[model samples]
Target: MRRLHTRTARRRVVGALTAGLLCTFGPAAPALAAPAPTVAAPAAADVAPTVDDGLALTPPMGFNNWNSTHCRAEFNEDMVKGIADIFVEKGLKDAGYQYVNLDDCWALQSRDANGKLVPDPVRFPNGIKAVADYVHSRGLKLGIYTSAGTKTCNEAGFPGALGHEYSDAQQFADWGVDYLKYDNCNNQGVDARLRYTTMRDALLAATGTTGRPIVYSLCEWGQNKPWEWASDVGHLWRTTGDISDNWGSMLSILKQNLPLAQYAGPGHWNDPDMLEVGNGGMTDTEYRSHFSMWSIMAAPLLIGSDLRDASDATFDILGNKEVIAVDQDPLGKQGTVLSSEGGRWVVAKEMKDGSRTVALFNETGSAQRVATTARAAGLPAAGAYTVRDLWQHKSYNTAGTISATVPAHGTVLVRVSTDAKWAKNPPAVELGLDGGLLVEAGKPVKLTSTVTDLGRTAAAQVSVKLSGPAGWAVKATSPAGTHTLPTGRSLRTTWQVTAPKGTPADSYDLTLKASYRSPTGVRAENVLPLTASVVVAPPAGVSSLGDLPWLSTTNGWGPVERNTSNGENEAGDGNPMTVNGVVYAKGLGVHADSSVEYYTGKACETVTAQVGVDDEEGDDGSVAFEIWADGTKMAASGVLSNAQAAQAISADVRGAQTVRLVVTDGGDGSTSDHGDWADAQLTC
Candidate 1:
């Protein structure tokens, strides 16, 4: 399953721009700093006819074993059957998931005497047809994988369908295969379209003989701009490379796929690879965003995690029916960018019932308010509209505003419509802070929160309460309870909030909860979180960053460690911070797609660190280290691998409010990508 895990350099295409998609879906967000990918359009006469077998009316949702098991011994007939059983027992089948697809390494390295592909006897003792029969018995379809080249992507080098497409296709049809994931690997330098189209024609012929139509999926990694010509060739074509279980990989793939919304429809789709939820490489918040954005883009939603040991949180994300509805909408229209600025993105998708699914995405490192209007979301002008928060499972009425305070790498998905049934739902109340709170330990700060009724109906028994951590005192300065709040009216409450003495200088969450009831007496509650900083100014002279408190820290796989290497995806699980055989006494160890921010207080003059891929991962890790001072990139270590020695980097932080250290995957999947900032220090 090398094609499913390995990532190569992105091919820069120089061809015709999708002007129609840009005009219809809006332009790419400048804040992402990614240019739209271009492709050359072929002449009408030469374009291959797309598959029209009436399959994949919606982007296929299923489970693939490659991401979790790869080529491990666990990927056998029992594993496949167990997953199908989970689909039926755990509500996945009822959630609209159908196909149970297997990736590479499912076949023997050598074919049989008849030149037909053979399932690995040890992995599938019952043979391919028996396993397919078991899956079909569960009322689910089964899919198989192979390469268009001479050999598959696995290290075993299984035989591919390059010259034996008809024979392999006939074999798969005979085995009752319902889907095929055709990969690009070891192709012997053949043209991409020709190889994929040949298989498409072979599958058609085999289907014509057996009357079993198999869904065709092309995994070419977007080298040839498949979207421009593969519409009639395959049911779905990958628009980018494989996705890693990290934020940077997910975000990068999203940016690449976001610009190609116009090419997606009922029968054809733009595949951005499989889902990476519950892989322990990211937080639950990030996973939700990953799921939401994929659904919004109308990409295939293949579960990449092993379901046998999935956590409840993972199941909650994968089992959200409302979010799945957006992906399966009969309209088959993909979501497009409405606006993107400063790491805040607003994407909207038109549904079949005159509704729009809007996703407020925050790509920044901190929580921020992201907002858009109904008109901007492509909703018709109305005096009042309904906004349903898909994740929160709450409905609110809005005059037109669709906004939320989204966490870092988080998404707030909502459906906006003029449906009248939403009026019976709870009144939409939102909590907002008047200004930023920066307080000292043991000092009381006056924090004000404004509660607004955005719903169509008035709210009764509206009470606002402010809560904080233990040892912190909270006293209301204004009336905490309001008898009634009319529509469009707001109630402001000031709170005397204090942090406990000896509190560390870090970001803390202060919540403002508003409890109210609709005119019909339905109880409703809204909780808004505010991130306040407890500052302890650094002393004069140079200080080690490990000794100082950081404003915030996020890591790809594990908790950012001080004076250690990121040993595993857990807190307090790390070795001494070592880079290229050098042990560091103090610094930060993190994984790729990780960031650590310090409150410089506009006092630090310079920040320095010795950065590289940690030696714990041997010579396999690849990463890029960057230093940002107040949103300005001051220094960068371009693509440092574990094979290289550590490089010293310094960034001028004079007069900057915050200093952020970032490490990203170096054009590869973030497997074993352990990054270290050795001897990190700040000078004031």
Candidate 2:
């Protein structure tokens, strides 16, 4: 059965120019002292341009076609023209959307005679340059798609960037491609950084000859934290699995991108894939929440819905200026969940202006009043502030604390700013298990503490204190904060603890005390509670008799099946046979008679046998057994009497210490039944 690899919608944004080049460019205005563009030059050294360079250029915002087109790969001139016209007509370019991208399946199976990559004749009869020209005419940039692996999503079977990175890159550049979405499929086990770098270098090489800046979009599916390394290679790297139209899939994908806030900035970002905003899987409220969250995450605002006939609601979601501002904010700090209560989640992002943006989301199935507080977000004491609802376009001067009723599977985003005297100290210490709370005895447990510096950088010192029953002992302790815990950095320590021999299965608590020097040089204390548990030991051994390791010999006889055949056959005539042995009243008893069928010159003959037991290790004797057929005992002492005709055998004995079965050939040594034993059994 074929299974689909779930794709995450996010893409990694590589270096500044590399990053900017990957995004859609609105009509270029006069240069505003922008950083020198670090065009990727195809040098033989194989060195990568820094991520700083990629993020310094275009900061990635555009429209993608997948969510709108779905699996329909017939991207004809009319389709391209229609979408490009809408982008210009809707004023989306002025709203910060510039790239009109075509997703997978647009390529023909083979390249042209000129050795240039070929677009499908049926889909692009007028050629890619025509499409590029039209999109450019609309003052918008054009992006194309390809696979890093050997096949495109369309399965049209085009040559991938596997070994021909340079050629493929040149081909795209020669086609006047402004953006390249290099997908990861069919390319298994390739080093992510190297895989992406190869393409980035190729694009640079291609762009060098073409003298046009083509944005490199790395779509490795965030196998590695491309955000951390993608800035050096491409414009955007997907951060999660591909998104479905369903809200569950969308919210789940959004939640996964929360921890990656530190890596986003101008020109580089965590792509949550494309938008499914206009899809019918969710309500308008949910889409608004979706748009709001993506904007706050600094994710690439790639609208995946059809733009030509978007509903008013779709346009409203795409045109939410306040939310868009937060996304395009120069500071580019991604928002993260600060706290959660039931289905209500509170997320926050710190802006460059020293203000904070908070989003209260209700992911549950019903509406919920999400309460917000300064403490939950690691802010200073709560008091007075100015708050604006980004989606509602309304402002209110309220206290430091805020509360709002969020619709089901929806979110309310607010920007908070204040001129009040805020505390410069780190928030109350929060502790976490570096690995996990559960641990095996004698194994080391790593603990971590998050120390936040409200505004000013503060130094934090953390120490763990253990208190348990009399038998419990503290194995070792690392110095307090000897491991530097920078502001917003976590301090970690490994504690080695051993359980006492008689330790019972119970829970034990450990208190972690964290003290810190505030920016004002004042010392304060915060305490965290942690727990650990002990488990029961394994049963005493019966000498190698533990859990049944193999499935074949464990319980009752397994059914004879094609996969595990155990039947007597021509190929396996002399193989050993196994039977369920029964022990009764300290003696061996043959529950059923044993018999073997053998072919003697095309004539079948039946055989019978007798068995006995002998006990040597116990007061009761063991068993010695044997089988006989055609007036001949199979064997008395470790030998088979009938070497040729032997069909089956059985054995029964009592008070015996040990039992041994011997095989004896019959007088007639016929080759047809020369060696065969169908089945055997022993019972006591």
Candidate 3:
């Protein structure tokens, strides 16, 4: 049993994903997919893979014992009851702290002769059933932890339920457990799917008509790629190992889970372990960052600290309504990191109310200037926005951009309200360029920019101006052809860009300008002053097919599907379907049991590719491949049994404009499902 409760005593943390993931499915896809799907929002990748319990409409907010009690986590009913007292007394319950979870070490040294887990008699003389009743009296829920493995962490001389799923679950239901935090320790190498499912089924069966269903939390330390399928089994699944009370540990887990946002929905959340606020190891600013990040991600805010003696800063952070509001936003969309620099990061979240939140973080030795525009933070282009600095408790207004100087390890979290009322009449006509641009010097490569009218007023005479390297020619036309936009609608246009033959093998930025006149007579001008990188051949075509914008993916935040992805896959987080950052035609490793579609834009005669399962994670999982052209199945690869080598991929995409690739868990779920779509491309 790996006793994670002793986190403070642990030397190092496990499961920190360093490189970040790109959100679009497949590798190199951008988060902002071709605007509008050009027709409707692209179908979201497979619905959540968890069971439908209708619980966790938003991630739970609560308190857990492990981080605070450590080895003392054993069946100490009084301690739990005391925390329950604090919950009501300290305004936590009113602030939304409900569950009082008893993490590992709560069970007795051994099960009774009938094979039911027993609370330690000495520590819990009143019994767990009584404790549950007491917690209920406080208007709070009760939770307990057990392992799927042979023994729970901190063994404590108890035998795990290894083979006793039904009995234990029935026993807990009878004891009135409102939630179950099932850990993974000493499982004797049993397949995680069976063990977790066994318990899930047991819990379902054990519930009597009057019994409320338990909120199941799977704590396998993210090793089995649970995000791809955890929805059906548990309310929330831990995406990484334990969270320690330190900056690095907290940030590591945060970065790792960012890319898996799309996998979470109502009742299903991506767990990043527990929050370590007020744990005495990190500064208050760091704690705020930890809290804010978790909230923005819509993660369960299970604080693992001594609530009985929490300090003022702790109370201030724990009770911040604005920050918590963002987490509980009805939209339920998890925030993603928009951009990151040396020690600066900008994170953004789109809310249900149509407002957006942007968090600027500085992780350096001193204070630093961090800035971002509404568009860059993933917000719709707005002429002005109402900004509320959450931590500073100040509200202000800004035009387009929000900039601030933040202290080391600190964050400036602001909520920006960009209602249509705030829309700049000429709303710089939202524009974006797509596809991997790797054209040979003398050849002309095509480009497309998605233009949308973000304002309430219709606009006309919209024009897009593009400038390439000197002597280079770039041509662009509006998607609507007439260079106009109907309010709330979008148009996608094409561009033919060519570079001079003498341009050496280097990269240059293609500068663009978008302008339009609002019906109100205001020249709404927006400059995509952003430079588009146009790579000059050679290394750019490492693959036969052009890749999506590296930032796109199944989850936003750009998962570490490629070596270029900002984050790496930490072992304990899950098996890497795509591994070692190998540059596949798509992202790094295909996410286990997940699929991403690429818009071909242009029709192709046929598509052929070299594909393989990820070799880095060994050959434990398998993937089934299928290709669809313009919504028709073109080819299928019966489950590729080995992830260590290449599999030839071919699809009859003749004259089709969109090609989609789907990889499944070869029947056994996603164990070892690392995959790669190498050299994927269209024969234009």
Predicted structure 3, TM vs. truth: 0.57
Regions of candidate 1 where Cα sits further than 4 Å from its true position: 1-48, 434-446, 502-510, 529-540, 543-594, 601-603, 608-657, 662-681
For TM-score, candidate 2 versus 3, the one ahead is: 3
**Local distance difference test values of all predictions, in order:** 0.81, 0.54, 0.65
| Best candidate (score: TM-score) | 1
Question: Per-residue lDDT for 96 in model 1?
Answer: 91
Clashing pairs in 1: 49-232, 50-232
| CA lDDT, candidate 2, residue 54 | 42
Ranking by TM-score: 1, 3, 2
User: lDDT tens digits, residues 237-301, model 1?
Assistant: 88875676767668867888999999999989999889999988888989999999999999999
Minimum summed lDDT over a 10-residue window in model 1 is located at 19-28
Ranking by lDDT: 1, 3, 2
Lowest lDDT block of 10, candidate 3 = 20-29
- What ranges in model 3 sit over 4 Å off? 1-50, 73-75, 208-210, 419-684
Q: Kindly provide the TM-score of model 1 when superposed on the true structure, using C-alpha atoms.
A: 0.81
Cα deviation of 336, candidate 3, in Å? 0.9
Predicted structure 1: lDDT: 0.81
Please provide TM-scores, in order, for all candidate models, with all chains considered together: 0.81, 0.55, 0.57
